[model samples]
Target: MEVAQFIIQILNGLSYGLLLFLLAAGLSLIFGLMGIINLAHGSYYMLGAYLGLTIMKTSANFILALVGAATLVALLGLIMERVFFRGLYKQELDQVLLTFGFIYIFMDLAKYLWGGTPRSLPTPPLLEGSLEIFGAAFPVYRLALIVSGLAVALLLRLFLEKTRTGMIIRAGVDDKEMVTALAINIKLYFSIIFALGAFLAAFGGVMGGPVIGAYPGLDFEILVLALAVVVVGGLGTLRGAFWGSILVGFIDTFSKALFPSFSMLTIYIAMALILILKPSGLLGRMELS
Candidate 1:
């Protein structure tokens, strides 16, 4: 590849990886704190994209659509956690089955609601056009995504490391019983965190809509990729998810460029190697099952 093309590819990898980080960050938090592998998480992402599309088309307001879709999904997450997941807390099998079922239910709902048409969200005019980098013109929106992802990473780090609720959450993850003993409403905290995770997924969906678009089977595809990201990044740390996304994003992007038909295989190979070398992941504290 030419130097310009290679440089653009690097940016492409970073942009795609950042998008995955948005999705995987939430997945990591939910599983790390609650030990529930939420298969439906991807459904939320899809719903968010579709919802953002609808709102944007109707209101012609991208920001409104982004926040609205994410807020609605977060509410749904809060409800699901309280109504269903709460009962299945310790029952891993039940949790898995229930969430998996929700995936189909959600997919069907999306079909019924939005039809099977693939749609793309509009990029703000402010981010339209391309910028010259290394003699290659790169999409401005992608650069925005990179910046947004980094901003989110910093914010999340601060939130988890510098805030009381975040501190309580970390504590609860380590020792739920002890947190409860201290009069902390661990269940409420869990509900909030779960909703927050959902929020992030939906936010990611909207954030990614302009690039990946909304489509009929996108949910499972995104879910699988996001799962790989968190698993490779290590289950419990935001830092892991960030770096994992960058690495996986690069692997997937470069593989597609070089071996388009077998890109996913490369990712799996990389993930397998990582798991072999460190079963706990690059920075994971939780054990993989």
Candidate 2:
């Protein structure tokens, strides 16, 4: 491949990697903080995309659509946590089963309301073109994704490290019982963490909708990928999610670009290798008891 083409592919990979990180970060956070394995997480992402499409189509304002979609999804997440997930934590298998059922229900609801057809959203006017970088032209929206993802990552790191609530969350991850015994409101923390995770997943879906058309089966496909990411990155490790997403993103993207025949299998192969070598994952710590 030409140098320009290779550079373009790398940019494409980084964009994809960033998107994966956005989605996986939420999954990692919730699992890390609450020990709740939410299968419906991807449904939240789909909701964001559908909501964004509806808002943009109705309001004809892309920024408003993003804000509206994210807010709606975050509200839904809060409701789900309070009404459902709070009680299901003890029943891990049941939580998994319940959320899995929710996945279908939410997807069907989306289909009924939006129909089974794929929907597309227009990129914002400001992000509608390519930029010349190192003599290679790359989509401006993709560069936007990279910037946004990195910013969010940094902000999250700061929140978890510098803020009081963030410190509590980190403490919860380290030892929930001790933290609770210290009189911290673990329930409240769990709810907030869940909502935050939902926000990230939903936001990722909204951002990605313009590039990857929103379709009926999008949630299921993305869910599988997210699960792979969580497992490979090690459960509940935010930093692991970042590195794992980039690794998976680059492997899948580069393989597709260079060896199209076996591209699809590369991610799974990488996951298997990671599991075999380090079952706990690259950054996974023992779950708090």
Candidate 3:
């Protein structure tokens, strides 16, 4: 029974970690590629949760809710990037202040639209059950979360590594001026990347809503966790994001289960150790710092 419990906990950690990756990946990309200090990224996640909840309640379709929320947030991202963020590029302080301002605006909008009550989406009927793994009944929804995260991760990896657009984006990350010199539309690229990042964040939010619920301060909570993931995973590297998410996810889940009173402390301790031992993170590029 003890062994079974441990295995279940590990599975839980993996699901949670992958979810963290979904949030961190886009963040890493924006910061690494575009050098935008978007403190309001978490607000997109909150927005998605609220929008997803509303759509799920009305349409009774989780997939549609996901699509709707992601699309809307992506548009929002585009608008913010083109109108507000474009001039602030590389001006870290200005970017931070602007995005920070948006955070409050978004939070207020959420309260006005959805009220102050917390909301949660029910697990879709198709995934509302459990599957026996090693004699323990693990939640099917969690298993699905794991699968979805992995699928998205794999697709993103391919998009980054295998596609021409991915190659250009990577080259842009390395030398934006050069790409611009080559007559590439840097502004358009930035807008697209920003929107893509927002889409990913919102998608993750929809997936996480059933588990974490939509609440007024959720943006701040998730922002902290996502920032932790980004920092631990090493800034600006997808590989770092993947491993960092898994490491932080497992540590957090296990600590909460085994040492509930010291969960927060344990996570920070682990982060401190990682920073001391591998300052660039496990898979992060050393040049990033």
Candidate 4:
């Protein structure tokens, strides 16, 4: 391949990797801290895309769509946690079943609301065109995605490292019983984390909508990729999630470019190799199942 083409592919991979990180970050946080297997997480992403599409279509404001979609999904997550998931704490099987049930409900609701046809959000005018990078034209929207994902990651890291709530959350993850015994409102904390995770997933959906489009089966497609990211990156570490996403993104993108026939198989092969070599993942603290 030409150098410019290779550079473009790398940029594409980086953009995609960042998107994966956004999707997986919440899943990593929830699983790591709460041990809850949230199967409906992907549904939240799908909802975000649909909601964003609606908002953009009606208002022609991309920023509003993003904020509105994320906020709504976050609220839904809070409600789900308080009403449905709170009682199911530590009951992994029940949590899985309940979330799985929600997946179907969400899918049905989406179909009813938006019909079966796929939809896509229009890129903002500011990010509508392309720019030359290494003599190659690259989409501005994609570059924006990469920047947004990185900025969010940085902000998240700062929040977790510098804020009191972040410290408490970290402590809770280390030992939930100990944090609860200290009179901390562990339940409230969990709720907040759950909501935050939902927000991130939704935000990712909005950001990714232009690239991937909003489709009926989008939830499952992204869900599978997000799950792969979480598993490959290690269950509980944000650092792991970041690196894992980049690795998967590059592997998938480059394989598609260089070996079209093997693209589908490459990522799985990478995952299997990683598991064999480093069962806990590159930066993950938890063991693989």
| TM-score, model 3 to reference | 0.96
User: Compared with the true structure, what per-residue lDDT tens digits does model 2 show for residues 49-160?
Assistant: 9999999998989888878888888888888889987777667677678778899899999999999999998999899999997788899999999998899889999999
The candidate 2 region of ten consecutive residues with least summed lDDT is 280-289
25 Cα displacement, candidate 3 (Å): 0.4
In model 3, the number of clashes is 0
Q: How much is 162 displaced in model 1, in angstroms?
A: 0.9
lDDT tens readout by residue for model 1, 221-270: 99999988877888877888899899889999999999999788998898
Q: For model 4, how does the per-residue alpha-carbon lDDT over 167-248 read when each residue is reduced to its tens digit? A: 8888887889999999998989889889999999999999999998888988887888888887788877788889889988
The superposed Cα distance between candidate 1 and the true structure at residue 172, in angstroms, equals 1.5
Q: Which portions of model 4 miss their true places by more than 4 Å? A: none
TM-score, cand. 2 vs. native = 0.95
> For candidate 4, which ten residues in a row score worst on lDDT?
280-289
Q: In the order shown, what is each candidate's alpha-carbon RMSD?
A: 1.3, 1.7, 1.4, 1.3
lDDT of 2 at 229: 80
lDDT of each: 0.89, 0.85, 0.87, 0.89
Position 3, candidate 3: lDDT: 89
